[model samples]
Target: MKFEFADRVNRLPPYLFAEIEKQIKEKKAQGVDLISLSIGDPDLPPPPFVVEALKEEVANVKNHNYSFSQGEPDFRQAVAEWYKKRFNVDIAQDQVVALLGSKEGIANAARAFVNPGDRVLVPDPAYPVYANGSTILCDGEAVPMPLLEENGFKPDFDAIKAKKAKMMFLNYPNNPTSATVDKKFLKEAVEFARDNNIILCYDNAYSEVSYDGYKAPSILEVDGAMDVAIEFSSLSKTFNITGDRIAFAVGNKQLVGGLTKIKSQVDSGPPVYTQKVAVKALAAYKSAEPPEFLKKNNQILSERRDTLVECLGDVGFPCEKPKATFYVWVNCKGDSMEFAAKLLSVGVAVTPGVGFGKHGEGYARITFTQPKERIIEASERIRKLFK
Candidate 1:
């Protein structure tokens, strides 16, 4: 039987990583020993304490039931405490909503706020979910706020101010570009959102993944950010539990309420057992300093980042060592897809920049999530091919 997808479903762009996975499969089927740097998934295991806590939680039969759409009260409190301790920002339980993942929270937040024909300000060369997964699904027009290399891969607020939009999405310690921002810039974002009455969706998923004494800030750290912004943070990167699907949205009670309402209709919140484990994970933060587990994790990632960047430069793909995140955004200097294909042919896979957005056309993003030795191996493969 033949069937057709809805117009909105048809309008959705192909998920980029899905294409990468397909390529990996094809290469492996042909006997290639592919080293994939295409995805940001962490290769590290969750902390031992997290695993032990999960074991304890999973043993409780009471945790088998569906969780509140708003989240378990203790989990919300843990989120609030973490925000306070990490950012010195105050967050109320009412202002927090647990999510299966920040991906879904972001999409559902758009559902709660965006209407057909409404315009959303999205950064070009960003995580596609802000545009494809959220704005387009709501039939909203996505105005590209290009993050040009000249501007340090940050949106031109001057250009952004000129356009009217109902919402804007910004991610720092950013995914594809690995751009980092400070409170001063976040203040500017808050001011822009407040002046324009735009709902700012701040993706802080990579906030805990910074290196070299650089720390990422929450938009809520800015005064009055709670008036117009909601921040999404996930334990996936921090605790290396991506598959556990534990994340939360905080700030602006009304906005949180709206997202919670949307989630209630669509699905239950994150698993109760997972939330219990996440509570233990969040408890590891007693101060502004990251826990020992995270410090050690970041140290390893920093090592890998250094090795990959140096090797990429050696292999004719010169790029800056990003201060944050596990990605190196290489200047392909040509067609990104072609560059990625060349790497794939050599059994090293990286994400094509064009798959991210039009502004990303001449670059590719490589992840340093693998061990340092593996990263060196991938770069050696590239060096051989490029030379």
Candidate 2:
């Protein structure tokens, strides 16, 4: 007999990064020296303090046990305090839900709120999780909100077919596009969510990995936002703990509770020691003076962005310097896949924009996740090939 699969899994579109990985592997097999500019994962080590914290806790057998479904209180408390220090938004201790990562929280939240046929508002050229694992897995319909270049990649609120969407996913200092929104637009989004009874989920994963004096704000900073919004954050980009899978979901007690309920039924929780390590990392950030490691990371990213923009800009690629996020969104003014394929042919791998969403069609997103030397070399290669 043939094995059967769920309709939900079968119906979803192809995973973009997986396809990129396949092409990468194939190129490598042919002896191609591929300079990958695809994935947004950070390539640097986290703070020494975070690693030390993990080492300290791992020795304590007490931390080897299964953590609470709602997550450790110390971890949650540290997250809350970090929020207060970073965004100046007061969060009650109970409103925070510790997550394996923000990605897990996002998927669970969608499971919590989206019933079959419910509409989910996702930004065009968005992080794939919002439209894929979150919405489709819940049997919900995805409604795309275009983040046009004319609007600085901020959603065209007036243009969005204002409807009763159950959830709206937003990423600022965004992935793929690297668009950052100010608090004023955030206020508008909050009001819209409140009026429409929408659950606004802001993925501020790239919050700390910003550039050029740009500080990304949490949606919870807006007045009355807690009544309708839940913000997800990650240490993946901020502290280079991607492998650690540590993050938190905060804001809107009811929404956090809902996500927790779903998580409890599925998985117990991430390892307890990792949560302890997260506590130390967040508490360190709670200080008035930002850590040197974080500062150094952002500086390197900023330099990479400049180097890439200068090289690509010289070849008439029309890449605007993004305010935050290490990605520089470029419009190839042609098919995104074709452009990406061309880059791969020249031993440079990049993410095709159309893989993000329909509106991503003439664009490609290049990341600054590699070392400065590799980035410079990739830029030179791209310039030559693009010309």
Candidate 3:
């Protein structure tokens, strides 16, 4: 007998990054020296204190056992405290649901909230996980809320209201687009969610990776937001703990409870040692000033963004300089996948925007995750190809 596949799993568009990885492997096999600007995985190391804490916790036999499903109390408290300090929003430990990573929380949140055939509002050119999680796992429909350059990549309230979706996914210092929502936009979104009886799922993974004196605001900062919003944050990008799989969801108690309940049935909490280390990470993050290394890193990437913009302009593929995050959402002159493939042939790896959504057609997402010298080299190579 042949094995059967579930319809939902079969219906998901090919996992974009996996396809990129395959192409990367093929190119490497062909002896191509690829300069990868495809994914946003950070290249930085976690703070030294975090590493030391992990070592200490691993040495303690007590930490070898399973942690609580909702995570270690200290970890939850630290997350709550960090949110209070960072966003100035008071949240209780019960309001926090620690996750192995925000991605898992996002998927589990959809499973918890979305019923079959429910409409989920996701931004166009948004994070792919939002739609995939809703559609593939929750049996929901994703109604794309078009995000355009004209609107500063912010969702149009009227359009979203028309959809009347049960849940809306909002990401700022946004992935792919690198668009940051201002306080006004966040307030408007909160009001919209409340008025529409919608659950606002805010992905704030890049909240701490900002530059240009612009701080990313949490949707929870808006008044009454906690009544209707749940914000997911990750130490992945912020503290360079991507491999640690430590993140949290904080907001409405009921929503957090729903997620926690689902999580309890599915898996045990993140490793006890990881949570112990996370406590130290959060504490260090609270007291530590921005280090000179990150300052220089951001400056270098900022310059790379400018250089990339100029280079693309010279090649007639102009793009707006993004204010935060490491991605540049480029409007490809024609088909996104074709352009990406062409670039890849030349040993440059960029993510095709169409892989994000239909609204992402004719665009590509270029990440500045590569080293500065490689970024400059990639820009030159891309310029030569286009010119």
Candidate 4:
């Protein structure tokens, strides 16, 4: 007999970034020196203290065991403390669940809250995981709310009201789009969730990667938000610990408990040493200022953003400068995949926006994850093609 795949898994769309990675590898195998601005994996090393903590914890025999399903108390307390300091929101330890990553937390949360055929509201040209997780894992329906440039990439509340969705996924300093939400919008979102009896799942992974005079706001910052929202955060972008696979879910106790229970059934907890290291990492975050290296990195990115805009402008493909995050969501003149394929031939790897959603068809996402010099070189190469 032949093994068969689950129908839900079979129906899922191809992972776009994985496809991009495979293509880039094939090109490099043939000796193409590709400058990749496709994925937002940070190139910078994490803080020294984070490394030291991991090293120290790994040597402790007690830390080698499995951690609590909910999380170690100290780690939960540390997360609570960090939220108090960073977002000025008070959270109890019971309201938190340690996750392998924010992505896992999101998928698990969708599983916990959504029943089969339930309606899930997702932002268009937004992160693909939200819709895919809901549709494939939870067997729920995805109602895409188109995010237009005219609305600064925010979904219209009226549109959401019309859909009568049961759950909504939101991410600010949003991936692919790099759009940030303000206090007024957040308050409105909280109200919308409360009025509609919807569960608001806020992805806060990029909160700490913000630049300029802007700070990324958390959904929990709004009054009554805790009653209807659950926020997921990761150490990936904040501490450059993507490989560590440590993140947390914080918010409504009942919701957190639901995800924790589901997590217990599917997977064992994160390693004890990792949680110990996370405690140290979060503690270090309390008094730590943004390092000069990141400031320098942002400066380099700022220059690259300007240069790319200027170069693309000359090519008749203009883009807006994102205030925070390291992505430039560019409006490609025609089909995004065609534009990306043409650029790839010139040794520049970019992500086609259509991979994100239908609304992303005319766009492409360029990351500033490459080195400064490579970015400038890529810009020059792209410029030559259009000129």
The candidate maximizing TM-score is 1
Residue-level lDDT for 62 in candidate 1: 96
Task: State the lDDT of candidate 2 residue by residue for 1-387, as single tens digits.
Answer: 998878888868989899889989999999998889998888888878888898999999999887888888888888888988998989877898888889999999999999999999999989999989999999999999988889988897777775868999888978889888999999999988888889999999988987777789889989999999999999888899898898889999999999889888988777899899888887777454467788888898899999999898898896778888889899898999898888888898999999999889999999989999999889888888867
Of candidate 1, the 10-residue stretch with the lowest lDDT total is 156-165
Task: Put down candidate 1 lDDT per residue, 1-387, tens digits, no spaces.
Answer: 999998988999889899899989999999998898999999999999999999999999999999999999999999999999999998889999999999999999999999999999998899999998899999998888898899889997877654568999999989899999888899999998988889999999999998999989999989999999999999999999999999999999999999999999999898899999989999999899999999999999999898888888887778888999999998999999999998898999999999889999999999988887888899788878978
Q: How would you order the candidates by TM-score, starting with the best? A: 1, 2, 4, 3
C-alpha root-mean-square deviation, each candidate: 1.0, 1.1, 1.8, 1.7
Output the lDDT of residue 200, model 2: 94
Per-model TM-score, in order, reads 0.98, 0.98, 0.95, 0.96
Q: Ten residues in a row with the worst lDDT in model 2? A: 283-292
| Residue lDDT tens for model 3, 93-116 | 999988999999999999998998
User: At residue 334, what lDDT does model 1 achieve?
Assistant: 97
> Model 3, which residues run further than 4 Å from truth?
161-164, 287-297
lDDT at position 279, candidate 1: 91
Clash-forming residue pairs, model 1? none
